[model samples]
Target: MAFSPEKSNFRSPLKGPPSPSWNDLLLKNKKALNHVLFTMHLQSRSNKQTPSSSPSPQIRKSLDFTLPSLVSDPISLLSDQILLSILSKLPDSQRNCNSLVSKRWLNLQGRLVRSIKLLDWDFLVSGRLFVRFPNLIHVDLVNGSLISLGECGCF
Candidate 1:
């Protein structure tokens, strides 16, 4: 029997590097990596012991109040449901100021706001210029502000 390397040992030249599929490895290790990252973030946050090094200016402000009695309680901003209910009842002309307070308020899906009145020319111009809502059927403009509904492609 002749010692033939090809016959005695089977090795594919095409298999020179065993490339493990990348997605399989990532999916397997996802939970472990997330845990490590979360733990490291918490550890770094806890290691900063001084208030001077605290990241939140709001927390620092709260600590600086010398007169505890004088410090006013922060008014609870209305929840979206309450704001929506209030918005439903309030006249159309009054909605913008309250809506302007927070992005969440701004994001109250506009179908909930049926009527919009533009009392201020700037507010009307800006609303006509930018805002889009499917359900807005009526817009009353005062202060000589006018929007050409014909010019606007919106139907």
Candidate 2:
């Protein structure tokens, strides 16, 4: 076979016009690409708005019964001791807010409070202090000024 450049399958490097750049190709198809993307977005939104298929009545009933038990407060499942330990780790500033969460949490937070400054002697006399903070190891009474004289000037 004769070697001929004109009939050869391969073309010379400089023979043809240069290939289009990515930017040019993308710009030319920009409107088409946008339409495709907009349709895809609408499809995704529709998919989210509606379920693909409805469950059977039996399956729905089963889910309805099981869902409540599954969704029950997970925090309530923790034991008092575990909750106390978790509460104890919180900083003093946060303890007050934690107590406000519930009566149980208030009691747990009180147990975690090891020390208290007594501002009112009536609290002690009424036994309300001990009731609120059962585990208090340190009680400050100096600030309460429990030694003030009565109207009769008696101790």
Best by lDDT: 2
Model number with the top TM-score: 2
How well is each residue in 49-147 modelled by candidate 1, as lDDT tens digits? 675666576754554343233323212223457557756665556566656766665656464665667555765556642364546777766534655
Model 2 off-target regions past 4 Å?
Answer: 1-70, 146-155
Q: What's each prediction's clash count?
A: 0, 0
Which whole-number lDDT from 0 to 100 does residue 147 have in model 1? Answer: 57
lDDT of 1: 0.55
On residues 1-155, what C-alpha lDDT tens digit does candidate 2 reach at each position? 78998777886678896678645754587567455444544454456664656556786557544543453454554569978877776678887887998999999988888899998888889999999999999999987755656734887
> Looking at model 2, which ten-residue stretch has the lowest summed lDDT?
65-74
TM-scores, in order shown? 0.26, 0.50
Estimate the TM-score for candidate 1.
0.26
